[model samples]
Target: MRSYPVDSPHAAGRILALTMIVDGNLVGSELAALSRSKILDHIDLDHADFQHLLKDLCEDLLTSTSHGAIQVDNALIDSVLEEIVHPDLRRSLLHAMWSIADADGWLADAEAVLLTRASNAWAAETNFSSPSYRRP
Candidate 1:
């Protein structure tokens, strides 16, 4: 798990930024869903900013994976979650993650693991149930 808290000032954008990386593959629907997401607004970002950040994050992930397998930075993610004290916001972030994972119509094993770890971590932090991603 590579630490991406790499001095990014975009605290809220980290969830989406990390989501794009966790699956190891980026699909069109995921990008589309992310772009259409109102969650981005709640994260203090818009579609445009999200796209820009995703692009950069993807590049970084690519660089990291060029060497070997990618891993989710659980500690870094938890640290990010720590900054978000609101239960609603944490739940929203969890939902956004599930949305990204399910965007491709199939949630890969790695994606599921990432979502589960994130949900558990968020729930532990907020003492609230993390949102689930239901297929449509």
Candidate 2:
């Protein structure tokens, strides 16, 4: 599993976000519920799981990025960055940021900056090495 030291700057917010994404998919609630719960009421992490699609999205991004272990398909990172490439996945990322920013349930200035930076970074990475769509 990709390991970012807990001491790394902003690591907790990022990891917490990822965890919520992976588990939230099953937990069927929100990031808050996903984090503080165990044994989701009715869900499974394996057996025709979400990883297949999640992996490709991450590999494609990482193949073009220097984000490395901190953002690769490392099981931990997969929980979040796996969806970095999909427009549909933004919800979870946004929600996670919302969670982080609103630990007090109210967005803060720095948290807004963090969310904006993360969103831009993820979006920018997607375009860096992507081949332009061209009918061949």
User: In model 1, where do residues sit more than 4 Å from their true spots?
Assistant: 1-9, 62-67, 73-83, 129-136
Q: Give Cα-based local distance difference scores for all models.
A: 0.67, 0.40
Query: Of the candidates shown, which would achieve the greatest lDDT relative to the real structure?
Result: 1
* Model 1: lowest-lDDT 10 consecutive positions: 1-10
TM-score of 2: 0.31
Query: What local lDDT score does residue 78 receive in model 1, on the 0 to 100 scale?
Result: 64
**Deviation in angstroms for 2 in model 2?**
10
lDDT by residue (1-136, candidate 2, tens digit) is: 3433332322333333344333223233443444433212222233123244335434544554443432333433433344244443343444554554454444444345445555665666554334676656
